[model samples]
Target: MASERILSKVAEEQKKHALNVAMATTAAAEAAVAAAQAAAEVVRLTGAAESCQRFRKFDPNLAAIRIQSAYRGHLVSPS
Candidate 1:
């Protein structure tokens, strides 16, 4: 029957549409995951850079103090 054939055709089209929608959803999920990973990497690297900067700022002061202490030790020691 023609009605049966039409119903079959409609069912096939619906199936294809559903598959397309599912594929699109999967792609969107993958893109979101990748973006989240990238953001996390940026945060980690920024934290590391800030920590290095803090240590760099401390290192020069520490070196100067060590140098001054060494000079004082030399002055106190006998010739």
Candidate 2:
């Protein structure tokens, strides 16, 4: 009867350990997915910024002229 009780206690401990491991695995997976999503967003924003730089370089004088014209019309910088 003592051996049976010891076995039962070990089984309970094993179940608790298994549950803890499963929760940790799930949390790690969620973190990995979030990191991937953030990386993708960074890539997308980087591409957009690069595209704008290209446009600015394509016609520097034209962009400056447009900015001046807009400013004259009372369009202030949002910054």
Candidate 3:
């Protein structure tokens, strides 16, 4: 009687604790994934910036040349 009631109460408390722990674990995992994504983005941006700087060091006028060529082509193209 009384023991059964106590057992039922204990089971309910255990279930609540398990649920809270699971929720906390899920939140932590989500935070970790977000942090990883942010780190990856930082790395990607850094790589892009470095590549641009390297390209400029090698040939700074390459992009300007391409743009001029495109403009000349456009000018010659019949409209």
Candidate 4:
């Protein structure tokens, strides 16, 4: 009868350990998912910034050409 009592106590401790392990695993998985989501957001924001920078690039030659074209047009037209 004492052995039966000891066996029951061992089984109870095993159940508690299993529950703790399951909880730890769940927390780790949630942290991993959050990290992945944060990484994806960084990638999205970086892509947007790069695209905007591309459009904002300057071209001095284009500016000069546009100014010259306007000046020629003005010189040839009646004042």
Candidate 5:
């Protein structure tokens, strides 16, 4: 019957539309995951850089203290 054929065509079109929607959804999810990973890497690297900066600041003070203590000891010791 012509009506049955029309119904079948409509069903096929609906299926194709559904498939397109599903594909688009999958692509969007993949893009979001990639963006999140990139953001996390940026945060990690920033934290590591901050930690290195803190250590650099601490190192100079520690070195100065060690040098001063050694100089003091040399001055106090008898030749």
Candidate 6:
């Protein structure tokens, strides 16, 4: 039956189209995940850099204050 043959062909084409659509969707999802991971990595690196900068700025000031406090304590505490 010619009609049956045509129907089978149409079904095969439909299956191929469906598979193509699924592959495209999977590719898009993978790309989105990769982009998000890259962005997260950038944010993590930036935060680390900022924390290091803050510690570098704070350490010397903290040391100076501690020295000053020790000197004052030595003068004020009666032995």
Which numbered prediction scores highest in TM-score against the true structure? 2
Candidate 4 structure quality by residue, lDDT tens digits, 1-78:
999999999999999999999999999997686566555655665565456655436742443454455545545666
Candidate 3 C-alpha RMSD relative to the actual structure: 15.4
Query: Which lDDT values do the candidates have, in the order given?
Result: 0.68, 0.67, 0.71, 0.66, 0.68, 0.68
Per-residue lDDT of candidate 3, residues 1-79 (tens digit)? 9999999999999999999999999999976865665556556655655567877777767555555555555456664
TM-score of 1: 0.64
Colliding pairs, model 6:
none
List TM-scores for all candidates, in order: 0.64, 0.65, 0.63, 0.63, 0.62, 0.62
Off by over 4 Å in 4: 54-79
Which regions of candidate 5 deviate over 4 angstroms? Answer: 54-79
Tens-place lDDT digits, model 1, residues 3-76 = 99999999999999999999999999976865665556556655655566766565645434544555555456
Candidate 3: residue 12 Cα off by (Å): 0.2
Model 3, residue pairs in steric clash: none
Least lDDT summed over 10 consecutive residues: which range in candidate 4? 59-68
Q: Show where candidate 2 strays beyond 4 Å.
A: 54-79
- Model 3 TM-score is 0.63
Deviation in angstroms for 6 in model 3? 0.7
Model 5 lDDT, full chain set: 0.68
Summarize candidate 6's per-residue lDDT along 22-47 as a digit string, tens digits: 99999999768656655565566556
Superposed model 3: Cα runs more than 4 Å off:
54-79
Report the lDDT of model 3 for residue 17.
Answer: 100
Error of 3 at 16 (Å): 0.2
Model 5, range 1-79, lDDT digits (tens) per residue? 9999999999999999999999999999976865665556556655655566766565645434544555555456664
